[model samples]
Target: MAPKVLVVLTSQDKFPANGNPTGWYLPEFAHPYEVLKDKTELVIASPNGGEAPLDPGSAKAFENDPISAKFLKENKSLWTNTQKLADILPRVAEFDAIFYVGGHGPMYDLHSDANSLVLIQEFAEAKKPIAAVCHGPTVLIKAKSTSGEPILSGASVTGFSNTEEDQAGLSSVMPFMLEDELTRVTGGRYVKAAQPWGEKVVVSKVAGSGSTLITGQNPASATGVGKEILKALGL
Candidate 1:
């Protein structure tokens, strides 16, 4: 049977602070989707089910990226008609892995979403591969293991850095800095590339469950994160 993977996106269409439109970053989902779509069965999902919004900034910034562009042109329905996260929880076992696609949106929603925490715990306990990139790792902030410890505690990981957030000029609006929170939860085990926005991928085994936790630093690393997921699954 082909390996099944759950690709999760944020349902938040706007930032709470200013109503600025925000959703899954285009390249973050598009690049990884491009890499994994042909190799696995992907189930697109979101917290609220339908109409996973796209960050207009990301769409414009990566408009020239052929993979992202093609995905937007041909796969709009996939994201627009995503399954609800709560609905998928009952059948999480059917998936071999779970991937969270990042954007500013996840910071406001998935980071503290109860269903998301449960889903992450289920995958972790099952020893399945769990992957995220950029702010996608925000979901890991509140996720806990069977033992009640932060899922990322002591796990080497990377995500959208503080510098990158500041550079984007939305640091003040973010609920919490992703790099700082990750570093705190990981006990300083968080790692990143030498330069801001540089591509960095980190793969670590969850301490007790041995589930693989894969993360990437920024949109530039999304493709690498998908490739690492395949590697973890031995594809």
Candidate 2:
């Protein structure tokens, strides 16, 4: 049997009503989807189990790219048929890894959500790799290690930077900033690369073991992040 991987997405659509354009970017999700497609049985799940928003700007800008074009063609089927996170109620030991795809929606929905926390704990306890990119790392805010410490504590990780939020013109509106919170939880020792919008991937050896929780700095880091995950999994 092939290894299975679970992919989680934020179900949030509109940004706090008056906020700027914010939602999942197409390549952020699609790159990983395509990479894992050939080797792993992939399962897509959303918090609410309905239409997962695609940042219109990403789709419009990259529509001509081969991968982006393919994603657009299959967009409806992949998202519409997505399973509800609640329905699957995944146990981390049942699969090989869990990946969280980022969009602005994750800041609104994944953080502090109970179900998200459950999945995080399950995956972490099972010692399975838990990979995230961009604002996707926001989901780790609500997760705790078996010892009750912040799950991200002592783990070198990176995510959407405050610089990126500023570039997106969302620095003022996001409920919580990723840079501040990640540092706070990690005791100011977390590592990051380049600027907010740059492509960077950080693979941290969690608990001082070879097991890793890989993260990508932003959308551009998607494919590299997926590659890092596959490398850590020895795939």
Candidate 3:
């Protein structure tokens, strides 16, 4: 049997402010999917499951980008029939590792989801690799240890930066500043690229748990994040 990895996506489809459409950012899913699918038995799960929405602007790939195009072409059902997080949550230990894809969507759903927080704790306690990108890191803010401590306490990580959020024209629309939350969640270093939209990836360890985290700064950092995950898994 092949190594199995769980990919959790946000089920939220509307932005909080005006109920504008939003979902998992595609390239963030695509690049990582391309990298992991070839090496592991990738399974898709989500908070609500069934047809995770794709951000309109993210549904298409650059004509020259093969990986994104490949994911769109090959993983149609995997995206369309995503299993519910509740289904996967109890079995997180069965996976070699777990990844969360980001978009504005995660901010609304995965951020506070009880199931997601439990899955995060299960993965972290077992010392499995926990990877997330962009706004997906919001889940980290809600996850706590058995001692009721922030899971990210005293660890290095990065996510969609405030600068990048502003650049994307959604600074005022987001619920809370992601960078600020990440910085405060851990009291550890939370640095970003010198400029917005630059590719940045950080591989950090949990303060007490032996688990390692691999986080990417933005969509452009997706592939890099995937590569780091493979390295962490010894693939």
What stretches of model 1 exceed 4 Å from their correct place? none
Candidate 2 Cα errors over 4 Å, as ranges: 17-21, 90-92, 207-211
User: Quick one: best TM-score, which candidate?
Assistant: 1
The TM-score that candidate 2 achieves is 0.92
Q: For candidate 2, give the lDDT of residue 37.
A: 81
- For 110-171, candidate 3 gives per-residue lDDT tens digits of 99999989988888888898999999888898898777778888889999998888888898
Listed per model in order, the count of residue pairs whose N, CA or C atoms clash below 3 Å is 0, 0, 0
What C-alpha lDDT does candidate 2 achieve relative to the native structure?
A: 0.79
Rank list by lDDT: 1, 3, 2
Give the TM-scores of the predictions, in the order they appear. Answer: 0.98, 0.92, 0.96
Best by lDDT: 1
Q: Could you tell me how far off, in angstroms, the CA of residue 204 lies in candidate 2 after the best superposition?
A: 1.2
Question: In model 3, which regions exceed 4 Å deviation?
Answer: 60-64
User: How would you encode candidate 2's per-residue C-alpha lDDT over 120-210 as one tens digit per residue?
Assistant: 8777777788899998988987688666767787887888888778887878778889978878877785556655577888887555333
The C-alpha local distance difference test score for the whole of candidate 1 amounts to: 0.93
Lowest lDDT 10-residue stretch of candidate 2: 203-212
